[model samples]
Target: MPRSHWLDPLARRVLQATGQLPPARSSATSNNALARPEPALPSNWFLDVNRGSQQQWRELPGCTDDMADLLVRLQRGGVQFAAADDLFRLLDLPTDLAQLWAPHLVFNWYGDAPLQPVRSCIDVNNASSEELTSLAWPDQRIHGLLRERRLRGFRDLADLQERLCLPASSVEALIGRVSFGQRRAGPSLPPRG
Candidate 1:
């Protein structure tokens, strides 16, 4: 004979106020903790100066409206910053501010935060005519200077006029863009007896 399930007459009334529910099962598929999205991270120092919005720059540590404006102007002006020192020189800011902001700055026109060991400029003493032609300077003027430089290198900016017979105004204009430093020399040999 099959067993029959049955309830007592008072079972419904006795259990009326006592709610009953199935026990919760541990779930690997369902989330056990609250879900939260990650926050947006801030840009690095170089990026903050090169590409940051005016408001973002103002929000940077120790940055004022004047400072932020100048940074934006310098970036837009196409100035190539080779290091934090260049930024300090360009802005003429207080030493304290430069020191404070240096950690967040980069030395190149690009926004990447790579540390550049040397500031690059056109090496006038070693550049080929092809390289000189790439510059904004006048082709004819550069050619004349190149010929003179090949014969005997320029001693200084002042020498351009004397050595190549270039105009004073042209030399003055090119001085800021060109580097007069000698090329990096190879390792020296030991002194001979």
Candidate 2:
């Protein structure tokens, strides 16, 4: 009753050579249609189609029937590499696959600015002593300036420097790094005690 029992060594070899011994089945049909010889894997396999055959020889197993149907649909639809990355991400594919397809992912792939340096905006009015200390300046002078600003409100940058008795050149140098802005005006200062 078993199909293999009917096959002898020579007969099996002959059948295999002629592509006749294995009776055509759905799996075989699907495999035959999808599988093609891939000579070598490329550096980034998903991106370099020419390096590896366009054929997807192995199917992702343990997929539900619905998932299998979806994969077939995706194959027929012909996914762009970028789109494929998103699809795999949405489906929560393995990390290896995600990394493999990351180069192809369109979300943040390429743009005019290849690299952009980070710049931070410092709030002069609300920055803590620790935050102010992080700047390239004397920590004592910064602390003194912050104290002066807290006691007597600064109308402008010049007023702030004057209140703290700091040098005009120092203030000028720090202008680009520092920013002055009005605070949100908390609770009307509790009617000044």
Candidate 3:
């Protein structure tokens, strides 16, 4: 079928993927990179909600360091934003501030929350040895993770991978399921009276 046969965007994308629909003809806008408004971006221009780096999140105007950290932290932990509403609600952004970011945001994932894979992100920096062991990783990886963290905190995926020398497959598996943050410190029990 021709691309125009599918009126809906989702149907078109799905059909295109299945090779049932011909791709739409290219247009003058194919070379959009030259006129991209954001100059700091390395390659691709859009900031995708599903899978984008922390640096991409920071490119948005009015995106604070804390906000970027929270966004990346939450996303890395398996939280997916369905719409601008999700971002506004989770981040507690004022309407005006959300308005500023609304246009720049792109949602790559399609469909409801339950329909997607349900993987809660594990904070490698703070998860208990038990929690880390419960996952598919072997005992050696778990021990290595805990031992390395004893020396210092993991910074990001790259930092963790470099520090631990994780195999490519392990790092790939860890992408959305792992995050790094300051270890939650607990107060010691008060001295007995």
Which has the greatest lDDT? 3
Best by TM-score: 3
Ranking 1 against 3 by lDDT, winner: 3
Tens digits of lDDT, candidate 3, 86-158: 4665456788778667777788764443232225678888888777865578888788887788777887765
* Predicted structure 3, TM vs. truth: 0.40
Model 2 over residues 21-122: C-alpha lDDT tens digits? 543458766687668632233534343311222233222222344544443433333322223433453345687655554453333323232222123546
Across residues 16-66, which tens digit of lDDT does each residue of candidate 1 receive?
A: 545232223356423442253222224453444555656777655556777
Model 3 pairs in collision: none
> Model 2: which ten-residue window has the lowest total lDDT?
49-58
Error of 2 at 178 (Å): 1.6
lDDT over C-alpha atoms for residue 102 of model 3: 74
Once fitted onto the true fold, the runs of candidate 1 whose alpha carbons sit more than 4 angstroms away are 1-47, 108-193
Which ranking of candidates, highest TM-score first? Answer: 3, 1, 2
What overall lDDT, based on C-alpha atoms, would model 1 receive against the true structure? 0.53
Residue-pair clashes per prediction, in order, are: 2, 0, 0
Give candidate 3's root-mean-square deviation (CA, Å).
17.2
